[model samples]
Target: MPKSPRKRALSSPHDALFQWTFSQREHAVGLLKAALPSSLAAAVRWSTLRVEKGSFVDRALRSRHSDLVLSARIGEGRVYFYVIVEQQRDVEALMVFRMGLYMMRLWEQIVRDQPGLKKLPPIMPVLIHHSDTGWTAARAFQDVVAVDGPERAALLPHVPCFELRLIDVSGGRAGDLVEQALTALGKVVLWCLSVSGDDARLEREIARTAAALDEVLQAPNGLAALEALLRYLVATHARFSVRKIGRLLEKAAGPRAQEAIVTTLDEIERRGERRGRAQGERRGRAQGRAQTLLELLTARFGAVPAEVSARILAANEAALVAWTTRVLTAPTPEDVLVEDGKRPAPARRPAARKRARRS
Candidate 1:
């Protein structure tokens, strides 16, 4: 059969972009500083910041979004501070509830990972929202709960309540972000992601961001970061065409920027080709397996029924393996197909009444 047209990539480009950009220690620290309160931010030992592995939020909720968890020493090395980066494209009304759940999960993980820990780390949840519409939902978990007047006061002590630090990037003001972000790379990334929806603003700010990144680009990891950013822009924004971006790069940082852009685009194309090849190989293997099972069934039990044949062909790799294994010892085709240790129940018909004899 002719292969169906390749579907668009299953993964969200925004998720990939967010993870790649903020995974760096400097960028993560910059984001934390910008989002956290001045007093709280000052207490964090920025140099001791480290990204934690695994996610606390449910996998279903994180399907097309990205989050970061980091731990840093605070209180002059006496305590640990936890920061959760909840990056979302839209405002969520149940964000506080989700954050609360994530916090509990994080604490559980901490206890599991550190057997002798004396205390749980203090957690600070930050919501990084970037949507066309500004965030208008309640920022606190208490606000989400149903309580009125005196009842609310009564329930306050019993309820788990906390607020998330909010960073709204909906305005798409590159200058303000640049001033707010701590590092040069952070500024550029924040500007790019913030202005992704606005072509005019992105074009206006690209030159300034490029100039700022020039010094950083000279560093060892600068070129890599630049490539990542360019790839992110191309992947996340529909307005960012290669030609347009290439021209912008050339204008901003001249030949070096152009070279970086070409390199990044080439790498992206290579990855896509590799993924396509791998997918084709898997499909070919699956088809071969299906065909082998059908041949076995036909040889062992004579002509396979259309329904059975269809089921065998539709079966995934695991099911095919199970059927293939059963074909050798099963007494009949139905026995081979039906699940192990279970038989299909016999059909029953309704009985006719004999009331006419009485009449």
Candidate 2:
């Protein structure tokens, strides 16, 4: 069954690009075929593969997960494949353990949705790490456990286990991964992933994927996709802004592609300006709320301690509003600022104070 698209927020530029590119059936197929073991990729019916909208990521950990789930039929059984684009900059030591937790969530959802399902479907975990330094963490669940050589045989049965199929987006081998891709857009996507955050490599890769980039511009909604790609590159690549990308596109892509490239760059710049202004407005609103909250606290109580003032200033708009709401009812700064499951710092104010009685 095709799942309806879920409303989920993307955490970063790389995540936005990852989901956008792979959500397409063609691009998804290309990655599965190119990166998976030949026998494993061949056993499944490619036509059965479809994106599953319900993400299994934990809400609090959404920023780190950047997950996409796809389901396909393998003969009489249904199989799922989970993709996680590791968004953090450094290699995570606990990643395999985290994947184990995610798998449990996926299996729980499958059972709930199906009700009387007798068997659990297997999930093939794919981890795409784009950290420039490359992945150094353990790849298999068993490898993460502390069981030593002497105890390996004794405790092996009880250990939770699964392995990750890594699509590493660093080192020169990523170019080889791109070469195995079947779709032009997939090739461009993989290349972009490979070169993100490296100024020199990104410039060099643009020249390499120029043909694929041009091919992308010819697809339906091609201009929009290209604009997204350009925006991603500009945002990640240290040296290239939209202007620099446009100038490079002019020289490298030549006359035929120049006009469209220029238009794409113009759109990117316009959106960027609008986004900047909107972000500025958000900052202004947060600052205003913080100031208002500080003043109210001062009037109701006394001078807010330096630490409390800093906390108010650093808070988001929502936090400020919540604190302000509590100011009317709550007794002290500690009570007003208390968050769920969290206690505020010890109050630094005088232990007792006289309250002015209303006439």
Candidate 3:
């Protein structure tokens, strides 16, 4: 019997992988067209699509959903479409509410940035859900609310209403996505996301996936797409190691595909090592600076107090340097330890009491 696939971790890598893949203009446009309603998709002028900076979600909520804001011409109007790429394992009950919040934030940012513009660009929100289970949550804010019928009708004009153009990839057909996608890159990415984390499904689709990747490899900017796809594959699969995936690629698409996969892996390893070394060097420098500051304080003040020594050790490189510079002119230990632009409190000495007889 085939071994069961290991459960993958729910993390930012999935969100990051999707963001990277869809950051490409062509891929983003293809995704919007494939996932959006036929009427909205038809209105988008693909050639005018541009990926914008800043996510709709605040920093804290970004891990749960990766956002992509793309501006495009829709029926002669320039509109922003916020794509919330959700990779959570379970469905969020308040997804519609969250979408409304994201849309409002996007609008706020637009107003803040372009103060002179009298009219704000309309936003079309899209939610692309990729989880093990299909999304069953309400797609409109009104649907999730308590009020309904007559009461809902009375409050409809007062309350915010927005609907998400949802694309549920869980249990979706790869053939459907492939047929819908405009570019080979889009097709392969959509197919990969649809079957990710299922070793059995991945194994079954290996040949088709390899063929799609090979087609992407031949196109312009193919190398980047290949690297992104390889990274996504490694990220999503728990059963297959990078080496195992590379071997699978070799078997499916020959040595060239395998070589590309291996090269990308090697490059990632090299970058990681370099980053590690750089961080280590930074920490070493900070420690050395802290030690030097401690020594300078000891030399100037003679035997630093426990509290001061602890502060010195805890201080970062910048703080250590600042204190070390102050040691040259500061009269007291307190003065030397004091932060820049702040005066140390003056020491108070009790005056000598006059003799009772003399008074």
Candidate 4:
């Protein structure tokens, strides 16, 4: 038996979106099948794919430990696929070396758990690179070894080096998703992620990818996924407004998505001022402040549950103001907004005493 996975609180907006979309078994399976080399994809047992819990990412690099780990029957035994979504805006040459570190840690964990085991199962590291800039980093650990090929070749036998499978979903490769063996929702989510950096392209891609996104809405959790994807898109592309995003969704999924779009728009757009939703309206207003607080909470803590979203929406003006102030310093949503299944009442200003009958 393996250690159970924890309820990881993803820290970045990108991580939250990826975790929510890919963690679903259907999507995960699709991603793994497509990303794996054809030989392995053909041989692995898809029915036995199981998501494992707990992360092995180095704590020095991340505020929150996260990544998707899954195992499946390959041959007579098992194999692990450690999947991590890297959303760097620039090329990270050290990414594979870092991935190497993560893989070693995972192997160590498996060894610790099964002390009597003679041999270790193979762990394949798959990196999903989502960037505005396409991936330009070296794919193998040896590529970054800082030695000439001749010299590196001499030392290579001793170096415990490995390579990672890459799936580039940067702005330039959005169309590649169509060829990949992904579900409709997976394609839509990756498509949205791919074009997030190009606002103009996103508008066009939304229509181009409309069919898949429409299929996404038909799924049970499609609405929630759509909301998360839109929030991320609008949040990252400040130039895109809620109305614009809603219109895009309406255009893509038809007018029926309007209600869901509006509800999410209102919730997501409050801080529209910050994320380029409501332009030139950066005043100290209630809705703008509320939206900002909501975004901050989601970025740090993961998706806010519906009840928590309602609580944020229902908060008094003072509470909204207080929560916004607290969110900057607070560690969790509970630290900033929630307390005892509710938010603590906003601190009140003391009444001033009047001079008695001075006249």
Candidate No. with top lDDT: 2
Instruction: Give candidate 1 regions above 4 Å deviation.
Output: 1-10, 76-90, 115-119, 173-181, 195-208, 212-216, 238-253, 316-322, 334-359
Model 4: residues >4 Å from true position, as ranges? 1-11, 63-66, 149-151, 174-180, 263-359
In terms of lDDT, model 1 sits at: 0.69
**lDDT tens digits, residue span 1-359, model 2:** 21211122113676677787788888798888777777778898989899997877778876656788998888789779898876666788888888888889999988988999988998998887767578889999999999898789789889977898887876545522535556787777776766667777766756776777777777776776776677667767656666887777666556777888888777666766887899899999999999999999999999997888989989999989888989988878767898993777675667787888999
Residues 1-359, candidate 4, lDDT per residue (tens digit)?
Answer: 11111122113556666777777778889888778777888999899988887677766645322488899999999999998876657777788888888888888889898899999999998887776568888988877877775677789888776888888877757322334688887777777767755788877777877778778777777667677777667656788776887888888887766677777677655544454643344333666667777898888888976666777776666778777777767766766876545755655668988879956
Candidates ranked, most accurate by TM-score first: 3, 1, 2, 4
Model 1 error, position 209 (Å): 3.1
Candidate 2 shows a clash count of 0
TM-score to true structure, per model: 0.78, 0.74, 0.78, 0.68
When 1 and 3 are scored with lDDT, the better candidate is 3
In angstroms, give how far residue 175 of model 1 lies from its true place.
Answer: 12
Worst 10 residues of 2 by lDDT: 1-10
TM-score winner between candidates 1 and 2: 1
Candidate 3 lDDT, 80-190, residue by residue in tens: 989887766789999899888888898899989989878878988888787776887898888888886678788888877788887777765432232555567777766
* Ranking of models by lDDT: 2, 3, 4, 1
**Candidate with the larger lDDT of 1 and 2:** 2
Error of 3 at 196 (Å): 6.6
lDDT of each candidate versus the true structure:
0.69, 0.77, 0.74, 0.73
